[model samples]
Target: MSAAPSRPVCILGLGLIGGSLLRRLSDTGGPAFGYNRSAGTVEAAVADGYDASTDLSAVLERARNDDAIVVLATPFTALEPMITSVRDLAPDCLLTDVVSVKEQVSDLVRRLHPRARYVGGHPMTGTTESGWPATDPALFEGAMWMVATHDDTVADDWLDVAGIALAAGSYVVPAADDAHDRAAAAISHNPHLTAAVTATVGAGESDLALRLAAGSFRDGTRVAGTAPDLQRAMLEANSVALLNTLSETIDRLITARDALREHGDVAVIVDDGHRARRKYERIAGSPPEPITGVRIGDARWQEELRRQAHLARVWMG
Candidate 1:
């Protein structure tokens, strides 16, 4: 009897994130298979020298259990269905995702495929633009990659998974699902929404206001131009964390407003804001220190999760 053929590693969703991953995999000398919701995306991917299709089952049929890695690069709203389809079609293959919200997706994976090997990931970098045309091969280069896996529940080797992320030129950060989600909400999603609000506020101003808009306005509102649907999914999925960050933002604004109203020193307000912003930039710009080699207790892990959860709830509320 002949043995069954192994399926090829298939990347689902050929948008910016998916296309970037496909480009990375192709550079590594492998024929990366791609699946997208749009036929145009699939055709473009095929023309780019990678295998491409919109058929889920057909893509899975070409994947092998060991060599096959399913990367769901879709939006947060499409995650559950995409994951469910992958699980049903590629039961033996390892599953991973590029979704921004890890906690919600992780929970869904755990519930849907209790025994299936899965890893939740979030790449902490992307441009305001999207689609295949917006995809760059170096998109993930020097970026932060968050890998979330439960100790007892996860079966597939995280090292193998981490290797894939490293190959894409990212520094891997091993964190709990919840922690990754909350941190991303604070750093990425919340910032995008705030930038959008800032941009909208300036829209009503005169041409004089536009001319007066210097580097501050440009820098502060850059992310506001990101795709509305993508931004919506990210902010809505992690609303808890986003809200928490928003609250803090509101409080700061209130403080500044009160201080200014009370005839506070303008220099004091500007200096305080500058220092805080600089500190944030420093922390976010730094690389993730390796936390894999060391292991901690269940209590510690639970505590950390609780802390992340609390932050999300507090901010979102």
Candidate 2:
């Protein structure tokens, strides 16, 4: 049997996050492959001159090597099944994900794929849009990409996954799985939930609120229009962490309401919010420390999978 090819980066979904990574790889360097459940999505990628496949075997064939990395960009709902599907086929490969919920995925990867090097990742970027057509290769540029890992994971395993994130222009941020999830709950998950509720309330009894809604209303509820399934999956996946954050947000809302009803000072709440907003804007402008060593976008994605699968078949035979 021939030796398996190495360094292949296989993306196992062609949604916004996955497609964006594929585009970035094409520009920056490819041995990058994309797979989507929808054959049409895979064909669309092929038309764009990407290495893509609809078949699981074909996708795995591209990742069947020691140095290969498979990035699962599927919804958190599909993450466990996808992890289970590929666990034994590519034992030595470094398998990671671009899901929002880290603790669950990190825990599952640890339990199900002990032989595979797993790093849970969340790229902190997206619009209210969804799917391949809405994808931008530069989406991750200047964005924070959080990676979650446990103590048992080695340094190289973390670096291998971080490489894919940085090569696409992300600012690499590392955290423990539970910590990452907790932070995500406060910063991302709760905000999205609040946006949805805001939108719902603003829809109002007479539909007048929505009709009269201006930029302030539009801006506030922007994320409420995000793909519902995506929102549901992520919000549900991180419910434990999010519940605490939601309670805090509700408390603040009640405090603001009380100040209005009780004729107490509401300006203080406004001042605090303004201060927080300014701090956020300032932090957004500041650059993070650059991460080194993620330059692996130069290989043909599927060839690596093909070679590995052939090697596997021959060895088994």
Candidate 3:
């Protein structure tokens, strides 16, 4: 991977994801540049000691060539226009995005930039926050960063996306564009909508319920507070897959409701949920028993160690 002298990493949007990437890029001894559409936001990033610009032309001027990597951290809706802008203004940079959906983006990149080196990416990590101010440098740490590409995407292009993710403290997962969308719909998209609904229900409840809202309620519906525009964009952009997931979710909910009403065994549902939560905790919180290679950049010690532990536990017993 190239450092500052090779090709700089340019982030096109300074949202939470983009800003967080910029923060990590700075530590890589690379020339990291940031650009946000809003002047005020750009100024804020600049004040934080990043090379940021509100002017697209300036960002393009500083970063132009195949060596450069331009990460489009914009929303899915803004992707096309940003790609078109890059096409007309800047030299071909390795194009990538941090958008949640992948299949639609993969198709769009293939159609719009026929020969462009593009890979679709989504880091499955974020808070219910927005903008640069909400960015945390360690946000991607231990998160699963999924990367997708068309059939023709080159090895180097894919690695570049994965490398960036790794640098941002994530483990990489590769998938086909369609597979990414379908899986993401079930895990990320629909679940968020469910969380929002849960939150809404709580909000509409009596004051007593509001006061009684505890860990389970708060934890389950935490994502409901996510930036409204961003959440809507993610759900709408991947509506086909999301709708399918939603239908499945609805069916499951109905089954649970029926079980409760008919005096059917509800322990099965509760047990499943309890087991799933434990599995989730093991994945997210268990980062290998003892993290080694603390100073190594290329060795994925943390992820590898934890994965080995998991495999041992599953296979040995």
Candidate 4:
């Protein structure tokens, strides 16, 4: 693993992602603490020997004093209030987020806390679970964590965020905000919607059908078990990209349905899907690419990093 971030971290939200991040940082001896809106969650985290509290002002104050990297791990709908507090209390702190959609979050940061050095991030890993109780310290292990790079992004701020991701055992993929959202919509958001549809159709069938459901059904519908509110928040925040991707998916499905009805064959969709799945498997099973160093303050560093990411390369701290 790369070196832990030099600055302390203050996570503003103690749900699954935030809690797991706190746990992983603590396990790695990184200086980190968290804040949660729920008193119950705060109490549980405190009881478990974590530095957590329900006082938003105090957490942001500490972040300001220590110049900590403040991670906003709240849901999409909850970001405004949290960013408001960060703006009020920690205006100059290095801010980053683990929110699923990057463009929206980056826009919010620019609008609400423009003085803060903000680097948008999204870790491409999770389970069909929610809240502090479902937190797993190793949830991000070997996962792809995206760090957003734009023309105005501060190189050192990006490095700090990437360092945290690397310390958590994740490979850093540097991408622009819009590109991240569009790609995530195709892979993550669209899959969740399809999973929900598949699960609903399966459940609508007879009891015997559900009883006979095995590995394929279970695997396909696994993400459908995520909290509805959470899924809705994420999906709705990336609506434009999700809509485009879903339209493409619907068209493909319609083509398959028509082929099956008219010619009794679905080779077009089936063969394409098989090839895509195999490509994914091949990439997933392949060894990691060698780390390439990029001069952080170079004029074209952002472009270099994005180029490396497009080629499936990672940057280590």
Candidate 5:
């Protein structure tokens, strides 16, 4: 693959993701610039020795003809318009976004800027925090970086993006836009919605009972603390996948309930739940092997699953 060009990089959002990327790029000698809608955020980022501004044109102008611009902070509602604006302002620049959902945004990018070089990205890393103030240089360390690409993304440029993830202390993974969104729905987006529901139900109970809640409650509901708008964006962006996962989860819960009702003891259901959770835990921290098939139910899947289980055992020991 060709080396990443020497063109300066511009980030179009200066919130947590944008701010964090700016800091990482600065530390790593990576070309980095930023733009944000909020003057306060832009000023803060600039004051922190990052080249950030509130002017969209100014940021775009800073990017070279072939440079990459990473859209970091815009919400889903604003994304289409922003891409439209960016196309007008930086038509020749290669573009990428840190949006949580890929398929929708990738489709939008293709529709809006057919000539523009673009790839969809989800860093799969963030904290239960918001704003430029919450940005940390190390936030992406050891994170999973999903690059959603298609036939359009130039092979050389795709590798450059992958290299950025590696240099930023992340593992690179490739997935088609739909696959990326569905997997994220199962693991990231759906979990947040469930957490919100769990927390909401728990909070609706008597104040005395809530006061008596423990670590398990806090742990289970931690993702609920994420900004409501962010969570809404994720769910809305991948509604189909999220809904499917939700249905499956509901079915599983009903099955467990039926099992408990049928037998005096729920040992079988409990054992199944425990085993499933353990299997999940094993895969959680490890990189999955490239999905070699449409249905990951074959020997390769079993091998990767067993490898993860062994790693989990070693870590536990």
Candidate 6:
């Protein structure tokens, strides 16, 4: 079947991710608008000739009328109220999100707005910046934007959600909510924690240590510069997965420490880490396999899409 027509989009937050999305969709001349709680943000977007407002109710009402896809781009802590608004104002809208945590947001939608056709999404892209001023229309370009799939996921809704990601120049990776959370914990969330710790240690050592810090330290601690509240919300929302991943990471560090103390060698940790880094480099440098021939709305569509995602495939549809 052919892909669904690009639907009008209503983004619920106009922060970095949401603002960037608004800019992107507007740049492409697609029907899109956004709501920001901050009037200043609304004014800025308006000044840029984008349709944005501080009125959540009006935005949702418009979405309901237009059958727009409502993207929740707010922080995890802010999701409850934003979702409640979607439930109240646009109960039948197609819902998706860019929040870092998938399972929690999916649960919130299921619990609060069961009537909404929901497909959880998390774009694996961002900088250590927040708000509209930091927004870049090209932020999601060449990024992996996970369009979540589940047993109950509607294929058409999934396609609608993936359409937005594709229009923003992102590759769509279909994944289940729990799988997305677990993988995100390993690659994204845990690394934030480690970056924080690394930055703290380097800063606490001495001014001289920080002064001498170069590319390695800067690259390692880059995400530690992300807003602390944002970091906490992301890490805590996926606390279980983050804890498990953190434990594994801590074990590796302890093992390395012990090996160094006992044998004056850290070869095991070094070699293993080196191999893992090389594997990452190889995969990152390679092009993703394109997924095709899978018909949406088929009985096993979600399963097959997820399988392709696990194999590092991209589905443009």
The Cα local distance difference test for each model comes to 0.72, 0.74, 0.75, 0.91, 0.72, 0.91
Q: Runs in model 2 with CA error above 4 Å?
A: 1-6, 289-317
Poorest lDDT segment (10 consecutive residues) of candidate 1: 308-317
TM-score leader: 4
What TM-score against the true fold does each predicted structure earn? 0.85, 0.86, 0.85, 0.98, 0.85, 0.97
Model 5: per-residue Cα lDDT over 75-140, one tens digit each: 676787678877888887767788888878878888998887786777889989989999998887
Per-residue C-alpha lDDT of model 2 across residues 163-185, encoded as one tens digit per residue:
77767776556666777788889
Clashing pairs in 2: 30-299, 30-300, 31-299, 31-300, 31-301, 32-301, 61-305, 62-305
Model 2 steric clash total: 8
Tens digit of per-residue lDDT, candidate 4, span 63-101: 999999999999999999999999999999999999999
lDDT (tens digit, per residue) of candidate 3 on 1-317: 22333457889999999998887777667668888899888888888888898888778666674356888888888888777777776647887888898878877877777767787788888888899889887888767777663444566676676677777777666556677788789888988989988988998988899899999898989888888889988889899999899998888788888998898678767998899889878865765333333321335432443344334221110
Q: What is the lDDT of residue 93 in candidate 5?
A: 72
Clashes of each: 9, 8, 0, 0, 0, 0
Question: Would you give me the overall lDDT of model 4?
Answer: 0.91
Worst 10 residues of 4 by lDDT: 287-296
